[model samples]
Target: MVYDLAIIGGGPSGITAGIYAARQKMKTVLIAKSFGGQMAHKTVDIENYPGFDKISGLDLIEKFENQLKGKNVEILSEELHAIVKENDSFKISFEDGKFINATAVIIAAGAKPRKLDVEGESEFLGRGVSYCTTCDGPLYQGKDIVIAGGGNAGFESAIFMQNYANKVYILEYGPEARADEENQKRANENGKIELIVSADIKKIQGSAFMEKVVYADRVTGEEKEIKAQGVFVQIGYSPASHIVEHLADLNQRKEIIVNHDTMETRTPGLYAAGDITDGFLKQVVVAAADGAKASMSAYKYLQSKNG
Candidate 1:
């Protein structure tokens, strides 16, 4: 059967789009390999979502899933392979060899955090290595922790983690930190945070859990290690727009390009939202708003085509 709309993610944007589509009385199917994307897995505290002063990422994801159950959206847990446009409709193929047709599509597949790929990084996952400081910062209360990267994300996380970690070490591989001057000043002023420049991360070493982070001095060419209980990676993110790359236009960052006002891409009947799209801000609330706009735009496009 041809669905009226097919949403290609289960994150906040996709879930919100599904609800909005259901309200428009559209035959919608939401397909995602996993539910809740990064928000569910990485975010620990969500205080700026407007509805609740604070909520765990997993808890908010649960509420979104619960609300979706009462809607007319069909949920599919499958990995997408490719999307091919045929005539005026879209044929979405899955890695499992199954396929489905839809009149319009909304690609909300979000991005994933970039990894450091150092040794022990994978083995020590959940034990001491983490990608989201917000999720694992509290675990290292009164302990020392090392954060990799010197960009806005790294410095910002370092400042935020100061509340939990006794000492926050910010390591940068470059000659100097790349964060804004303001962030640099704040981090330097904070007694708990130590900004280390020209430090190249080598590996994470520990016996039971992560015990130390090894790095090399880029300027002096000397190796060193920092005793810490946890290592937080705050490099950046890579958008998950590979599946629909052939069907949509992508920017240099591999983010889907869409009209911000309507969340519609260059291709008619095709929309993208959330971190997958080229939006300035990557937040849960912003993603929800994108989803709402994409669904409404899809509904209007369908109405025009059918009439």
Candidate 2:
């Protein structure tokens, strides 16, 4: 049977859209390679999201799962490879050679962390190089750590690692820090976290486990190396929009272009939300709200077509 809506993700936004769509009595199915998406990658505490004072990433994902248990939404552990438009509906294709036809599609596949394309970076991924601070910080307790990036994510990683690490070095490629003022202040007050501006990470050097990070001073063009057992690349992220790249209108960053108010994409009956959308705010709460909006807008679109 053709589903009414298909949410192509398992993150907060897709889960929220599934819950909302199921609540509206629509035949909705949520598909993903796995549940929780990037929300399960890190072990950080989420305080900004409402309802909980502070929740671990794993615990929060479990909570999201619990809320979706009896929601009548069909959750599929399928890897969405591509989406093709067919007639007036859409066909969702999976890597496992499965297909599902839906009247409306909600593309909520979230973004992934941007990796530092430097030497020894990919080789020592599990050895010492990491992308999630909260996930790998505990392992490097009492050891010197290096964090790349100057945005809020970088500072947040520094804040979390400062308590356990002997030294925390933040490398920002710009002249000044771009993180929120409050976070920068906290990082500065600790004194354990050192902010290095105008710095560009050149390479990571080590044997089996990471030993030191090599960087270049952008201003003076001087090369320097720091003793760091652990290196966390907290640069930024890129949307997981490759599956629908040719089918939808995407911006320069490859983020799906959608209406901020409705989450409707350029193509009718196709909607997107969360980090995949062209929105500045990348918060869980905002994603959840966007998911709700997308589902509601899809429901209306269905009603109009049926009427």
Candidate 3:
């Protein structure tokens, strides 16, 4: 059956949209590869989300999913391949050669962490190198680990790792950290965290997993090696928008360009929200707000078409 609205992700943005759309009695279907998106693997405790002093990333997403359990929103575990407009409707294609037609579409695929692209980085993924500290930090309890980056994500991971790891080294390529002052203060207070600035990771060495990090000082061009069992890379993130690249307009960073008010893209029936849209801060609260705006715009668009 054709759905009234097809949400293209299952993260906070899409799930929140599904909740809103379904509550409106609109036929909504949530198509996603997974349930939680990036929040699934975070090992840190999140206090930013409302109504909770502290909660695990996965647990919060699970609560979101549980809220929609009995709703009309149909949750499908499918990988969206491409989207195309046809007449007044939209057609969504899946990787398994399946198709779904909808009157409106909300694209909320979210983003993935940027890779270091250094030697042994790819091979050591999960084995010793991880992108989400909340997911893999506990595995390295009382072990030495290296965090590559000095941004908010890096500092957050460092603070989280202090709970489990014996020592945490933050290897940043810049002279100073880019993390928020509050987060930086907290990281500094944690005696276990060692901040190494202006250093670039040259190589991640190990046989089966990551065992050491070869770093080079950007200023003096001096080389230094640190022995560690695991490495958490939190340099930055790239939006997951390649599939819809041809269908929408993107900004300089390749993020979807949308009007802030309506969340409408270049296409009328198409809307984008969350980190996939061009923005500086990628936060869960902002994503939820975007989803609400997109849903309202979508509802208005549907009303105009029906009227």
TM of each candidate vs. truth: 0.81, 0.94, 0.94
Q: lDDT per prediction? A: 0.91, 0.90, 0.89
Model 3, position 293, has a per-residue lDDT of 86
The digit string of per-residue lDDT tens for model 3 on 108-136 reads 99998999999889988888899888778
TM-score of 1: 0.81
Off by over 4 Å in 2: 52-54
lDDT of 2 by residue, 168-210 (tens): 9999999999998988998888689999999999998899788
Clashes of each: 0, 0, 4
lDDT of 3 at 69: 80
Error of 2 at 266 (Å): 1.7
lDDT of 1 at 165: 88
Q: Give a tens-digit lDDT track for model 1, residues 88-190.
A: 9999998878999999999999998989988999999999999987678899999999989998779878988888989999999888899989788978885
> Where is model 2 poorest over a 10-residue stretch in terms of lDDT?
37-46
The superposed Cα distance between candidate 3 and the true structure at residue 22, in angstroms, equals 1.3
**Count of clashing pairs, candidate 3:** 4
lDDT of 3 at 243: 67
